[model samples]
Target: MSARTLGRARGPLKGSVSVPGDKSVGHRALLLGTLAEGTLSVRGLSAGQDVASTRRCLEAMGARFEDAPGHLRVLGVGLRGLKAPKAPLDCANSGTTMRLLMGVLSGQDFPATLAGDESLSRRPMERVAAPLRLMGSSIATTDGKPPVRVAGGTPLKGIRYALPVASAQVKSAVLLAGLYAQGETAVEDPFGTRDHTERMLAFLGHPGPLRSDKALTVPGDPSSAAFFAAAAALVPGSRLTLTRVLLNEGRLGFFTALKEMGARVSWERGGVHARETVGDVVVEHGPLKPLRLAASRVPGLVDEVPLLAVLCAFAEGESRLEGLAELRHKESDRLEGTAASLRALGAEARVEGEALVVVGPARWRGGRVETRGDHRIAMAFAVAALGGAGPVELSDAACAAVSYPSFFSDLEAAGA
Candidate 1:
């Protein structure tokens, strides 16, 4: 673990920046490409540790990857061509890797075991495993968590399932396993989540047509764009342009929240890539009113809750973010972490049942905040530091490398 003190910006942040490729899209592309019938080429893949974990796991299963600067050419092994790994697949800290790969491994002809680092090991696998088990796959877990074991070669029967919770990972895992099932596999989420896997599958020529309401392209990660947008919106005189950002409706909850709060934000449509809509967004400093987010909207912006909490800290009046129980299971207890970070920076925030309430127009008195080994928490607080009263000391700042390898550098480049 490492620590750093981030100082407040001396002037308004002004610049244009291109964030790294979307982590969610990058992971799905590599995983789906590994199992596709022909060669697949991916541009602007994320160079982050979590996505790298997925690549390495796929390689362990005999998928060939030819890497270039900013691009990847994957020769997929066909749907049934993967060989069992000689050892247990180590998923490191990526829950997405572990959960999603369990689906891929379920239909193989050989048994497979998946394990991960401490943080990932604590995440519940049963949300994914229970459904896989329903598909006739022989799978087991240690008390519903990691160290998951799957006995492959079992024929799967696709069945319709309604998600108990709205989760892109669980939905994607079921859909991936559906590729090997005997019939169409369907998952319905009343509260929609990100659809990167579905979009990438369609792009790669999946035979079925998705629901009309679910059509998509896996654009740039709007969650990543939230950090920069916050810095520009909260820091006086700050004006920044984020290029080629994903405008997926399911992933735009944070931006919508900002707009509802009266932030000075606008966008122009750009071209599409990989079946994902892309656009350039301009954000500038402005007065933000309080926002009340409903529980139904939580799934769309679940990843951005920490950043939204930070933005709320600087906005006038109280902002209540509801439907955040899922945050308890992320890389960290993000709800607790978000509130702690805000309190450490002299803001008033607390959890009320499933909602996080922040009383703001905060008078920031910068102090040390713990990252708890969460990338989003670290990045959110770092953005908060840009408009703070003094230097904000962050413990375990390096954890941001998990999702955004160049986050600190990008922050500097944007003059934050």
Candidate 2:
């Protein structure tokens, strides 16, 4: 594992930075492009390892990609055009690739096995497998985990599924399977999750209400912008503007929580990108106030909880983050990882039931943070180091390349 030491901010993080394209969007774009009948042009695609994993897997299945300076032109072979791969499809550390691809492969006429790295292999694949099975896809798994084997040539039928949890991946998986089913398939989540897949499908002229008012152009990732927002909020006099970020309502819970915590966060409507909302976010350092986060909002900002925990460590008084049981199934046991990271940074944090309670305004004496090969955990702690009492050393710091390859360098450029 690679390690890096992060020092306290030399000055307020001040600058306008362009984060990479949305990872969720990038993944869906590539997958949908493969099923598209014509050449699909994708602008500002994420250049992360996770998206690369999706691209590699698709190429193995016969999709061709034409590269451009900052975009890609994918010549799709249409739905049902994917050929069976001779070898198992390795999704690497990307659960999105494995889960969503399961849906696509279910409708194929040839068998395919989806495998992943150790961390991803440990994540529950049965959530996706069980649903595809309902659609008549024969899938076998290693105790509900990775190495998911899908037996192709099985006919599929559409069924309405109410998600037990709000999972964009599972929902998208089912919907993708629906495309090849005999009838319409619908997924209903009690709490809405990121709808990138739905939006992209509609944009590509797939039949459904998932269509948008404008053409599809993927916006910058809000999750990536959260790290910079946290840095700006923690460092005095820090002001940062993030450009062309996805401002989808279902994905703004973290920013909402931050605003409630007294962070000076604001946004202006930029325009639409890829049928998704795009905007400019301005985050400035300010006095943070402690607040309670409802459990219901967890699904919307699930990916940002670790970053929020870092902010909570710096805020005055106790901050309770509820309804985070889903964190247990992520790249790591993020609930435990977040608490452990905070404790290592000299803050009071612990998991109580399904929630994480952090007693804060504690001195942030930075120390070693174990990332457990989770990219978000690595990046969150890196943000925490910006205002720490000492240098924070992150083990497996290179794991940030999974999502944001330029994270550390961009952080340094932001003066943190």
Candidate 3:
């Protein structure tokens, strides 16, 4: 594994960063485009390895892709147009690609096996498999892990299912599979998820709200923007502008948490593009207080836990992240990994039940970061390195490419 050493910022991170396209939305766009009847051209798709994995898996199933200037034209094969892959589909490190594909493959008249890299292979797959099996797809995982095998072409009857956990990906999987099932397929998630898939379906002429425009322009990823936002929050005199970022209510948990922590954050809501709200956000460093982050807030900012954890370390009181059980199943045991990262950086952090507790303002004695091949972990610690007591060496920082390929470069540019 490769390593990189990041020092405390030369100065307060200043200037603007145009977020890469929202990967969660980017992933869905590619999947829905493949299922649509005609071509769907997407502009500003996230150039991340995870999204690339989705494209590769779809291509293996015979969906065609064409690259033009700033657009990816996906020639839709419709619902029944996907072909059987000659070999196992490799999803790399993207659980979104693997789990979502399980739903997409459920109705096909072919058997497909989805595999992933070592890290993804260890993450839970049965959460996606069990519900899929309930819908009549012959789906099985390797002892609740990856290498998910799906025998398609089963007669599916939809059932009203409740999500046991607040998982957008799982909800999306079941809903996607529901598209292939008979009868009315309904899912009730007590805690709602980002409605990208549902909106995409509607935009593509299904029965929903997102048909506001013909060409849907995906906005910048908030997840990627969180790193800089955290860095700016930690460093004094730091001010930054994040341009054209996704302002989805379901995805801005971090921003909400930031305001509660006393960060000077504001945004001008731009026009709605394809049912997604876009806006430019300005964040400035300010005094931060610890907030009791509850479980209900987890679904909105699940991906931003690492950055949040770092922020909590600099807060005056105890910051509790409730309902983080799902973090254990991510690319790494993220809850544990996050606590470990904080401890290395000289914070009092630990995991208690489903929540993570951090008592701060930490003594910022920096240390080495063990990424465990998790892209989020890698990126999170990189952000934590700024304004720390010493230099931080991150193992396998390249893992950030799984989501943000230019993470370090962008951080440098904005922090310069």
In Å, residue 88's CA in model 1 sits off its true spot by 1.2
Query: Of the candidates shown, which would achieve the greatest lDDT relative to the real structure?
Result: 2
What overall lDDT goes with each candidate model? 0.86, 0.89, 0.88
Better of 1 and 2 by lDDT: 2
Error of 1 at 380 (Å): 0.3
Q: TM-score of every model?
A: 0.96, 0.97, 0.97
The weakest ten consecutive residues by lDDT in model 1 span 209-218
lDDT of 1 by residue, 124-168 (tens): 899999999999999999999989999998999998999998899
Task: Give the per-residue lDDT of model 3 (tens digit) for 1-416.
Answer: 88998878889888899878999899988898888777777899889999999999999999998999888888888888899999999999999999999998998999999999998999998998988899999998998998999998798879788999888899999989887888878889899878888877877877532222245578999989888888888889999999999998898889989988999988889878877889998899998899798898898999999889988988999999899998999999999999998898789999999999999899887789899998898888887778673588898999999999988888888964
Steric clash pairs (candidate 2): 216-274, 217-273, 217-274
lDDT of 2 by residue, 108-148 (tens): 99999999999998999888888899999999999989899
- Against the true structure, candidate 3 reaches a TM-score of 0.97
Off by over 4 Å in 2: 208-216
lDDT of 1 at 380: 90
Weakest lDDT window of 10 consecutive positions for candidate 2: 208-217
